[model samples]
Target: MSSYLLPAIAGLLTGAGLIVAIGPQNVFVLRQGVARRHTGAIVAVCAISDVVLIVAGVAGLGAIVAAHPQVITVAKLLGGLYVLVLGLLAAKRCLRSNEAIAANAEEAESAGRWVAVGTALALTWLNPHVYLDTVLTMGAIANGHGNGKWAFAIGACVASILWFTALGGGARRLSHLFASPRAWKILDAVVAVIMIGMAVALFASI
Candidate 1:
């Protein structure tokens, strides 16, 4: 159906473009992938969250969220703090494990299911931008494009699933490639930069 086609294509592009970037979600997925942790579950959480947000946006609730300045401000402060703290913690982990990571790979498996869920949820719900971007912007465009709101939401949701799945699996492969303390340092540094950048962008955006 042409109606669905539009949403699918839009969703694919949105998913591909955003996922390809080395953003927070990507970092989390990659961490799972490399550690060979509960990659599927983590990826699934992100995909599901995306679908929910996109649907809400398309259904018009996204507009309500964007309009509430206080909510956005609160999300910014909270999300920023969360990101900064997480980034610091990750950096600390990297430093602590720099020498033993490659040797004790088994011990370095991801924390737990709850940790992954909390990380992904904070990355999604805590940032008001997710609401604005996927729900508000994508929803508005999808809805404005005629009777293709669900279609677009579907597209984006599908895209998110595919991307997160791939990244989570792909990152694990890097254990062989970046098998050095320097590599962990670099990755941790990059994560720190991304987290800090996200915080700055979020706060400045307000």
Candidate 2:
């Protein structure tokens, strides 16, 4: 019991360190959370995706991925293009007034569940950083524990669940502040900049 406990705790801390950063996935989750649209599904997709990646990493797929640079190169190019489009869309939204933004929200709500889930999946799976962090880095660390690696994996999964739950669920508290059109515009503008910057970084890497 103590064996599992120690490794699990180590995994929890290590996973938190990898995930709690400001990335494209975190940005999308926060936006959906504030809009209160398909927040649950978005959170679920992100967390579950992490679990799958982490498990794969622990299973030694990370080593295979590390050996294959072309896979990551493909993901980087595709993900960069996708994120660039999202950034441009957000920049367009930033130009709209309060009423238009509100109407857009309403329209989004009607069709956003699946859309949000799709975005969540793309942002999670397409981003090469996720592979580097969760799969390559965490997987290598977990293997060091040998017999306790599964316990470590469980702990890392738990960290992902908790982080996404808190991020998506707790963002509602800021919804009141986002009620103003100007606020929405500002938020969108920031999102655009971040997304674009991330896209640029990904392209530059390749």
Candidate 3:
């Protein structure tokens, strides 16, 4: 059997590095983890989406996308808008009933996997920066790894798995800690601030 150890590990680390930041995905993961709902779904979402995109990056699509000037411009605009919306939603979360968040989590419980995957795809494919990270950053990193480029990809994937697994698993323990409405409110408030700041920074780049 062909071994994907190096690629898997690289994939894992790369994915973790890119995703460990304070972003929407992290927010969603944190919220879901704190709630203890559909833990497996969340993990699958992060992992599967990573595999698909990493494959695309390694397949040369990353190179193609990097060459397009217009696409990059449009992507920056969209990323700014998306982050703004996410921030607004986060800010509004403080006002939302915990019941609503819990309910949405319930409704979302079934599709947690796809939700994660789709969310991953949207965030990556939709944001030109993802191309810069996965396709560009990861791709460049993959190059020097020699035959281990493939192994590096695998490592990146593994990193994602470890993080998400820790997310879902750790969430199980955090549920009780977030039992109060106040805690959720505070978290939402902070997440809103982060997202809004990122959104603002996006426009500054233009």
Best by lDDT: 2
Global lDDT of each candidate: 0.76, 0.92, 0.71
Q: What value of lDDT does candidate 3 attain over all alpha carbons?
A: 0.71
Residue-wise C-alpha lDDT for candidate 1, range 23-68, written one tens digit per residue: 6777877866776778888888888888788788788887788688
Candidate 3, residue 2: the lDDT equals: 42
Candidate 2 residue 144 C-alpha distance from true site, Å:
0.9
Per-model TM against the reference: 0.87, 0.96, 0.79
- For residues 1-206, could you state the per-residue lDDT of candidate 3 as single tens digits? 24456555666767788867666566667776776665667667766766666767776767787788677778778887887887898799878887887766546456556655565456545665666777777877776666777777777766766777887788778888876777878888987898788778768876
Q: Across residues 30-126, which tens digit of lDDT does each residue of candidate 2 receive? A: 9988988888999999999999999999999999999998999999999999999999999999999788887777687687578788998999999
The weakest ten consecutive residues by lDDT in model 1 span 101-110
The candidate that achieves the highest TM-score relative to the unseen native structure: 2
Q: How many clashes does each candidate structure show, in the order listed?
A: 5, 0, 24
Candidate number with the higher TM-score (2 or 3): 2
Indicate whether candidate 2 or candidate 3 has the larger lDDT: 2
